[model samples]
Target: MPRAKRFYIPGCVWHITHRCHKKEFLLKFARDRNRWLDLLFRAKQKYGLEVLNYIVTSNHIHLLVSDNGNRDTIPKSMQLIAGQTAQEYNIRKKRRGAYWEDRYHATAIQVDTHLASCLIYIDMNMVRTGVVSHPSEWRWSGYNEIQNPKKRYAILNYRRLMELLGCESLDALKEVHGQWIEDSLKKGKPAREKKWSRGIAVGSREYIENIQTKLGVKAIHRKIHESKDSSELREDQSPYTAIFGTENERLRQENTYRWGLF
Candidate 1:
C-alpha cells in the first residue's frame, strides 16, 4: 500500500519515534547510544533543527523537535542522524542490512497542553518501561541535562523550550520542568499506547480539524448513542487508522512483553 502523506506545518512541534529493525536491541549499548546523541548534536548544528526533548531507549528512540518551516530541515536532519548511526553500527558489526524498521513516525503536536503532555511522556519513557526508577538516572535522555543547570547539551534548545513554556527565566523554566516530571511520576506512568504515534495529529478537536482541512482530508462524522440520546464524534480519527482499522486488532492479538537490560 502507498504510504500516508505527512503534513509539515511551519512552526509546529513534532513527536517522532523510530524503532530498530525487527525490534532488535540495536542500541542496547551505551557507546551506541552516545554515538546517536553525538550525531544528533551535529544534525542540530547543521540543519538548524530545534530539539526540545529526547530519549534513547534500547531498541527505539523518541525525539521532540521543531522545524523552522524550512520543510527539508526535519527530514534532512533525520537522514543525517539515522544514516550515520546505521552506517557506523554496520561497520562495527561487519554486517550489512537495514538498521531501522521503516521511516520514523512523526506526529504534529498542539503547541499548548498537548505539547507539554508529549514532553512529559518523552521524559518518562524510561521510567514507564521500568528501565529506570527516575528520568535523572537515565543518561540517554534529556532529563538530566535539563535538570542540571551546569550540564549543557548543545542539542537541546533551552531558549525555545522556555519560550514554549511561557517562562520568563531559565531558573523558572527548570523549576517548572522539574515539577512537571515529578508530578507525572507521582501520577504513575501511562500505558505505552499508540495514541501519541498512531494519530494523524494530536490536540483539541478544533486543532485536529484545522490540520485535516489543510491536508484536504474529507471530514466525516460518526454517531455514538448514550442511553436514548445520540451524540456526534467531533474528533478526527487518523486517516491511516480509518482506512486500516483491522491492522490494529492484529497488533493487539500479538502483544507480548520483553524485558531488557538498561
Candidate 2:
C-alpha cells in the first residue's frame, strides 16, 4: 500500500514516535542516547521547531514538538532528522540496512486538554515502563529542567509551558507541575498497550471531530461481507503505477515531433 501523507501544520503539536526495526535495542548505551539528542537539537535549530518533551528509550523515541515551518515542510524536516540519526547510528554500530520502520507515526493534538494529556503521557512514559520510579529519574527528558533551577538544556523551555498554563510565577508553575504529576499518577494508569505507552495521544470525541473538520472529511464505517471466493476481488496489478502515465505519454509524443520538426 502507498504510504499516507504526513500531517504537519504550524501551531499544531504532535506526539511522534519511532521504533527500531523489529523493536531491537538500538539505544543500548549512553553514547547512543546522546547521539539521538544531538540529532534532535540540530533538527530543532535547523527546522525552527520547539521540542516540548522527548524520551529516548532503549528501542524507541518519543517527541512532542511544535514547528514554525509551513505545514507541509514539517514532515520533510522530520524525515531529514530521522534519516540523519538512523544513518549515523547504523554507521557507528557497523550495521546495515534500514534502522527504523518505514516512517514515524504522528498524532495531532487538537485541544489544550489533549496537549496536556500528551505531555503527561510523554513525561510518565519511563515511569509506566519501570525504567524509573518518577519522571525526574528519567535522565533523557526535560524532567530535570522542570525540577532543577540551575540545570538547563537549550531545547527545553520551562517558561513556555508556564506561560501556556497561564501561571505568572515560576513558583506557581512548579506547583502546577507538581499537581499535574499527582493527578496524572491517579488518572494516567499504566498503559497496557505499548503504542499508547509511547506517547500516543488518546483524544476525545470532540478532538477527533475537530480533526475531521480540519481535514475536510467525514469518516464513514462500512461492514465487509464475507465471501468464499475472495480471489475474484483481488487485483492482479496496482492502478497507482499508471495513474498519470497516459498523460505523460501524450505529452512526450507532442514534444518529440517539436524537437525533430527541423
Off by over 4 Å in 2: 149-153, 186-189, 192-202, 217-262
Tens-digit per-residue lDDT, 40-112, candidate 1: 9998889898999999999999999976757788888889988999999999999899999887878777888
lDDT agreement with native, every candidate:
0.74, 0.60
TM-score for each prediction? 0.82, 0.73
1-262: candidate 2 lDDT, tens digit per residue: 5533332333556678888888888777888788788777776677666676788888888887764444544465567667887888888879898788667776556446556666777888888888777788878775655655434447655556665656787778677767788877776556743333322233554544444343321111211122231110111123334333444334423211111000
Q: Which ten residues in a row have the lowest lDDT in candidate 1?
A: 253-262
- State each model's C-alpha RMSD to the native: 9.4, 10.3
